[model samples]
Target: MGKKNVSGWSTIIMLLTAAALFTGCSASAGSKPSAELHEKTMHWDKMPEMTIDLDKSYTAKFTTSMGDFTVKLYAEDSPITVNNFVFLAKQGFYDGLTFHRIMETFMIQGGDPKGNGTGTPGYSIPDELDTELKYEPGIVAMANTGKPNSGGSQFFISTGKDSENLNQMPNYTIFGKVTEGMDTVLAIAKTPVKETKPIEPVIIEKVVIVQS
Candidate 1:
């Protein structure tokens, strides 16, 4: 009778181990990949282009490690650029990314998944330049590689008086403006940097968009 009891307990323990292993595997398979993993295995070819109404306005609230700031997008003025930004924000593409470029008294630039200036959303969009709209202080605009229609995910927020000069070269697309949190924008601009890159990374926690 004692021998039979031991054998039954051994069988139960083996069954429980197998069940635990299966549960672990299932949980791992169902979990979403981390941002680091996604970056390594990113396939830009599958990224879809979004369409947004031009008549409506969209506001994006950015919660960064430095502070929070709100940007009011100019959809009517830059429909394609605004739509692209909205799509990326909703998809959580900008989360955990850092503002790689910072220019004191100029602007703070970010939106690269690689935490460097060269990353993109697997695609580039055409320029939506409007001569009527100037790059004044607190203005948010897309960062391009000087080539026409080279705007990608990177963008910069104007800081000091020098930003107005950006208007002379109508290459960057003016998409939004910082309606609130100018102080936070200025604080980010003041962060120490080595050349254009920041010494200590200012992480973007998340971006939320509200349609208006």
Candidate 2:
């Protein structure tokens, strides 16, 4: 995948960079917030379905017919977002999850409890589209409608080089990059989709955060 779509770590890095500047520093938990993360994670928002993990190198295990894959997260960059994900991963919020939306040459979207692609974790965060990160393949990014800062859990990965039109608006936080099983992601991306959307939903067996 040459990365024709922009959604992944590229977006989050940019957001975090800008957030740092705006907040007078990076988004750090003040004096260690609640570790009472979620024991189970529901769809996006709605409290992450688990407790928050402020700092840590987390891994998410994704099991699919294509195979099982893992991804690590950077809490330092986006604490609340990362914690929510981590909480959900631990709770297996994504266990029965499906890649609801798969647009060929664009991106694959998932993480909505509604499963139809529209759902939130209850609250939305401010926009964090920092320029430090650029749209690149294998990068993980959040999904949102025309609304800015409306990204919840609904996220996508760039199978190929996404257009810079994403830069048109400073939104959608990209947080992590798939370090392994990239071929698996590519294989999923190669699947046939109706009207450029996946005809068969790519379900996520579970999301387990990996430690490296």
Candidate 3:
């Protein structure tokens, strides 16, 4: 995928660089996040059914090499996006994935099974932007190909600094916000990168969905 800057850019996916072509190893520290790496070839022919109860609150606990963070999903505001995210989390689709694109001031993006920006879950979902969502720090949203209804498996978290710039590009669908571990999110944002890809891999060990 191609990449573009914040100014005069139409799509966030366009900011993808050649660094996405290579997968880096996690920095030396703790044990692997999972016992086995999740399969990458897993694909769906269509969007998942809405199985989650909208009356209940949903949160996703993300365990990564940098640390852990919890995102409260907006099921009522963005049901389709939340449903797909929860479905993938339950299916272990985000295990052993890397944050392929990390811009310190912009956002950190991952959930691409291919460890690159071009991979997807063999499906797509429509954009859900009718809420009072903003691209502020800790807000999580879906990344797309700058086309309507083009979002799939890739997602991003607003780190800080340049997050406000994202407001100008409102096509990405907002699904959740970080309720805990903002420090971890900020730390992950600072991971050394060559261009936009992390020089040392920041692995997303797993993503667990919790409901109440």
Candidate of highest TM-score: 3
lDDT of 1 by residue, 58-100 (tens): 8999999999999999888888889889988888888888877
- Per-model TM against the reference: 0.78, 0.70, 0.82
Candidate 1 to native Cα RMSD, angstroms: 22.3
Give per-residue CA lDDT, model 2, range 1-212, as digits (tens).
13345468777644533231111112221222235211223334345433444544666667786786666565656565666666656766666766766654555666755455445555555455653666567767666654666555667776765423455343567677778888888888788877544677677777767654
Which ranges in model 3 have alpha carbons more than 4 Å from their true place? 1-39
lDDT of 3 by residue, 30-142 (tens): 22224333338678889899899999999999999889999999999999999999999999999888898898877888987766566677778998987777788999988
lDDT of 3: 0.79
Colliding pairs, model 1: none
lDDT for residue 80 in candidate 2, whole number 0-100 = 58
lDDT of each prediction vs. the true structure? Answer: 0.72, 0.58, 0.79
- Write the candidate numbers in order of decreasing lDDT: 3, 1, 2
- Displacement of residue 37 (Cα, Å) in model 3 is 13
